[model samples]
Target: MAKYVAPAISLSPFTCPACGAYAQQIWAHAIYVQPHANTNYDVAPLRRCKCASCQAYSFWSKETEAQIFPRAVASPMPHPDLPENCAAVYLEARNVVGDSSKAAAALLRLCVQHLLVHLGGKGKNLDDDIAKLVKEGLAVQVKDALDICRVVGNNAVHPGEINLDDDPAMAGQLFELINFIVRETIERQKRLAEMVDRLPQGARDAIAKRDAKALNGLA
Candidate 1:
């Protein structure tokens, strides 16, 4: 997975926001001059940068040094342990966030639903599924994160209290929340199971027996 880093300087090596490749960005400034009736007009100067690794081009304003092309936004890469289906939707959301935050929020909401389903949710209503997971001892922080996505996503799709049209930052936050959910639920549990499996067989059996006795009120 690609780690996102903000480009600091024009000619320095930084992660390519377009393809997430870390490479040297070659920078050049160009100002187009248009002449009419013995008069020359200079257009706004733009700094062009090309990534050495991916050969992708990005434009920046010469004066402000702000990214122009590709509409720079800080979005995290999908978690390594995220399910393939959820990751696909997450990427889709990231792709359109710069254009339409409402659409991105809606896609993230869909990703959240898919993630819950992968975690044994019933594949029905999202609210009901979240409630069930909370009842099943989902972490308080995880539940809260899920609810934030759920509410924002809901508002994105339907006419709701929150307006997502002007809030790309909030939409960006949903990406991190989705990854956090995957880490808390899937990755943590998988790591715990792997640790348990690495224990000696005798120790594993002893733990099973202890758990059984505890369930049976004999511990």
Candidate 2:
């Protein structure tokens, strides 16, 4: 799936959030009037656009410049290498971010929890699972990223600790973190292993012997 890229201006070409296609947008003002004392007063300025590729429409307030239709905020595409289940939930969270950031955050937290299990973490408490992975040598940056999602997600579920609605941007960050974790923990390792597998058998055997001797020496 194509990653979402917000348009610099409403009329500018951009990746369609609905269709994930980069295309030009045709823009027009949507006028609405209210009758008061026999005089019609225009309401807030509204703008609408149609994607050239998908022909899908998006509406936004000219004053606020916020998307009103398809309430979901633009979210980065899920990493191409994410596991199927994790990717599904990630997209689910993305679809609802504008409607309820808290709900989206909660869903992302679940995605992280599932991802940990897929990464061989014990399917237990989220906090414990994260700690276990950190103990097992997860990169410091990845551990910090995981904790950000874990903490925000907990706050979203329990409420009162942090107001997600007040800070939708933080929820957006979680999506990026999810992809980052996958790239670091899963994609990077897979690429390295594939590269190692491509080495000549004789070289691979020699490397294995070298590691074995190092381990024996450590013993």
Indicate the worst ten consecutive residues by lDDT in candidate 1.
35-44
Alpha carbon deviation, residue 148, candidate 2 (Å): 0.9
Query: What tens digits encode model 1's per-residue C-alpha lDDT throughout 1-219?
Result: 455566854756877777667678897764455555555444456777888988988888878878878687668778878999999999889889888899999999999999999887876788899999989898999999999999999999899888887566899899989988988989899999999999999999999999998999963
| Model 2 spans with C-alpha error above 4 angstroms | 1-4, 8-14, 19-72, 213-219
Prediction 1 global C-alpha lDDT: 0.84
lDDT of each: 0.84, 0.84
- Please state the error at residue 219 of candidate 1 in Å: 14
Please give, for residues 115-155, the per-residue lDDT of candidate 2 as tens digits. Answer: 99988787578889988887888899999999999999999
How many Å off is the CA of 193 in candidate 1?
2.3
Give every collision pair in model 2: none
True-structure Cα RMSD, model 2: 6.3
